[model samples]
Target: MEISVFSIQKSKADNFENEIKEYIKMSSKFAKISDLTIFNEKIAKAQSAGSESALKSYDDIYEPNLKGFCIALDEKGEKLDSIQFAKILESNSQISFFIGGAYGLSQNFKQKVDKIISLSPLTMAHKIAKLVLFEQIFRALCINANHPYHK
Candidate 1:
């Protein structure tokens, strides 16, 4: 199965970018995967401002590029544990996961996705979210392969 991660911001810190790349490399060892595609938010500011230009920019970019089974990360989404997530990953025919900008995904974007998944109830920084998500994907791969690392 092909998995893609769509995010709204670029990696700002060198350390975080390196860590993300490390996980991506580890994940690729198990199976071929694409780099996290980062989309530039038009506003380049926090979402609370709700700039029209940003909303329009997102509409033009996010949906059209997202294909296959789309999953949006939202606080209100169904919460799943690591093992269940592994099952989901193993069973998926194709998947695309979206991490919204600081303002979060728009209502229209939310409607287009197949499902909403919450990584945590507490709000997380986008950078941390990316790292944690990649780690979880790696763990899921380990579980699928029955690797000792999972234990």
Candidate 2:
């Protein structure tokens, strides 16, 4: 399978980035995966304006990038167990997960995606959320392959 995680944020050199890299390395045996960080002067200006503007900006930028088996991480989305999450991976050869910016994804954007999922009910930092999503993706792959890593 091929998986891509798209996040609305500038690239960062930090511990979370290091940990995310580790998960990507570990997941290599199961599938090809990549993380794409997106942020530009336009997005920065939108963010400075307000949450609503930032969300609109996110929709504009992300809508065109939507690919096969698209999934958006949203606070109001359904919560799935690890096994359930693994099932989605087992069925889809190409998957794209979107992690919205600080203001969060727009309701219309989430509605347009194939699936909307929530990592947790509580809000988390963008980098931290990316790290968690990477770890879970690795775990889901392990579960699907009957690998010991999941246990």
TM-score list, all predictions: 0.86, 0.95
User: lDDT tens string, model 2, 1-151?
Assistant: 9999999886687738888888999999999999888899889999999998999999998999898899999878889989999999999999999999988899889988999999999988888888989999999999999999876
lDDT of all predictions? 0.77, 0.91
lDDT of 1 by residue, 1-151 (tens): 6778878775565527777778778888676656565555444543445655566566566878678778898888999999998888887767888887766788888898888999999999888888888888889888998987687
| lDDT assessment of candidate 2 | 0.91
Backbone clash count, each prediction separately: 1, 0
Each candidate: RMSD: 2.4, 1.1
Best by TM-score: 2
lDDT of 2 at 120: 91
